[model samples]
Target: MIIHVDAHIAYRFEEPTDFLLQMEAAAIPEQALSGPGLTTSASEHEAHISGEDAIGTRAWLRCEGDFTADYRITADIDRHLVDLDALNQLPPHQLPGATVPYLFDSRYCPADRFQSFVEAEFGELSGGARINAMVQWVADNFSYVPGSSNATTTALDSFVERQGICRDYAHVVCTMARASAIPARFVSCYAPDVTPQDFHAVAEVFLADKTGEPGSGAWHLVDATRMATAGEIVKIGVGRDAADVSFLTSYGIAQMQDKRISVTRG
Candidate 1:
């Protein structure tokens, strides 16, 4: 599979500002299953202007690879591994899942509120069945709604609202898994064939007891936002939460009044 992605972010400031700085993690890294063919980043910075000014930032990334790899699985849950190739390929700065202490933001701590929901849903099933059940539940109940929430939005907020984009959905799922004592993380990336959106979010749970191989269990992708199942390929940013791997940023006193993203795949 091969994919091309374009992301654009624009902000309008209320008054002239001296400086702006932003950290971007929109570029997807190559892994064992996929290869990054070509990738590029471009930004436009401006100085003090009139009452209203605008700043635009864009990123273009191209990737290509076979959809199936040596580690690809068909249906069985016991064949999962950590895909060490993928881990070794990542840059030092981006390696957080196995090394970082907290993938989610501190503000979102205290996950007691969401633990009960996970236990009730999967308590009767085996570990593998429990994960599958949770994934199915997310797919059945949520609907993707972009521009519905932002970084400050909490999992409780998402659960109550019942409507949000991928990030919100991923946060909700991450919270549930953590509450269940399952080590889970947030992932940000693009779904090339699904939609023309610049950014997307999914949750990866470490199903240690599901693989039947003892400590050999691997991370499984769960798309809470789109409610997608396993076997789908999507570029991803794995972290503790949305704050750990945000796709866009703004420096100075600018406000992002409007933003849009479109993605396409073949």
Candidate 2:
């Protein structure tokens, strides 16, 4: 399906600082673009945008005063969500070398601490089923409070607090899935129908087994947030955690004035 996505954000800086913005879409196999997928601010400024990396395009801008970032995209998402039961989790050695590291802990997703809990709850299940159970458990237990969490709240903290935003949900599930021996990573996404429209957070679990053909594996999108289904969402970045996929990182103090994101079927 084709869709249009846009994000506009205004930030007030305390002084001159360097800004790293990441709220742009990348051209991926699943997303066919009409033009350049990510467009930065038009205002003349010293900005350097590196090519899209495994995570996403990161642009550095030096600004002394206030700044505004605007980005838009028009693309078609061509993919289908596979049933969890149909996928088989691959052992670490069988997974692509790049996918192997996500199975371990990150700053946000600390899988080691949850080993005992995961074993007690999901050790009996194998493959996608175990991952699905973890997703469902996260959705069922975590409360979606808009301002309930901060940058310091890790997966363990959210598991104990029982409340957080999409990032927290993704973090907890990533941790649980990793604990269950499934390779999972955080995805920065632009999802249609996101209430209070904003950049969204989701997770993908690498499945070694597909429905047909031998040695077929794929990354399966699993959004415990449940706002947009797995297939329809637009992917931006795939990282070990949110820190690796943050929308913006600034070297100086900056307070948000206003932020808005919108996505619509085209």
Candidate 3:
């Protein structure tokens, strides 16, 4: 499926402030890009290509007054969503170096606190089954209340409150998978079917190689909200948790005056 994505963020600042932004759809192996994306800012500035992997290609700007970010991209997204029943976990040593960091606990997703519960619930399961179960556990149990969670909310907090937005759902799933010794990470995407269309967050777990390839496991995408369908999930970034991959990070204070994200299938 082909998709066109557009995102706009307008902000007001008290004093001069620096901001880091990520708003372009990734051109990955599965998602083929037709052309270069276009990014424009209200004020002139060069965006630095930063971050370790495909996680950042951002507009780093210092604006004293107001600013706006507009980014657009076109891609044929071939989202390779896995069968929840076929996934299996890989041994730690066999995991790629890049995947190792996801196995440990992070700020928003504190896996250590949930280790016991994860072991008890997923001890006998491995791979996709555990992942599917976790996704289902979150979807069926948690409420999708938009204003219920904030930047400081953690996986533990979401679990107790039983409600949050997409990122909160992602944190819980990542925490659970990490506790189960599965390498899991948070992903930000442009979801096609997401209501009131905005940026969306999803979860991914590393599944062990099943076709006689012990060290060749792959990442399987999962959405606890179950709003986005396959071929419509366009990823933008991947990291241990939201802290490492938020769409926007600011060095100074800025209040959002207006924001909207549009994702349309063509």
**Can you give the TM-score per candidate against the true fold?**
0.62, 0.92, 0.94
lDDT of each: 0.49, 0.81, 0.82
Rank list by TM-score = 3, 2, 1
Candidate 1 lDDT over 89-133, as tens digits, reads 122234334533432334443457866777777777544455556
* Candidate 3 pairs with clashing backbones: 87-127, 87-128, 88-127, 89-127
- The 10-residue segment of model 1 with minimum total lDDT is 66-75
- Global Cα lDDT for candidate 1: 0.49
User: Which structure among the candidates has the greatest lDDT?
Assistant: 3
Error of 1 at 48 (Å): 26
Rank order (by lDDT, best first): 3, 2, 1
Model 1: colliding residue pairs: 103-240, 103-241, 104-240, 196-262, 196-263, 197-263
Better of 1 and 3 by lDDT: 3
lDDT of 3 by residue, 192-227 (tens): 788768899999888876674767888878889999
Error of 2 at 104 (Å): 1.6
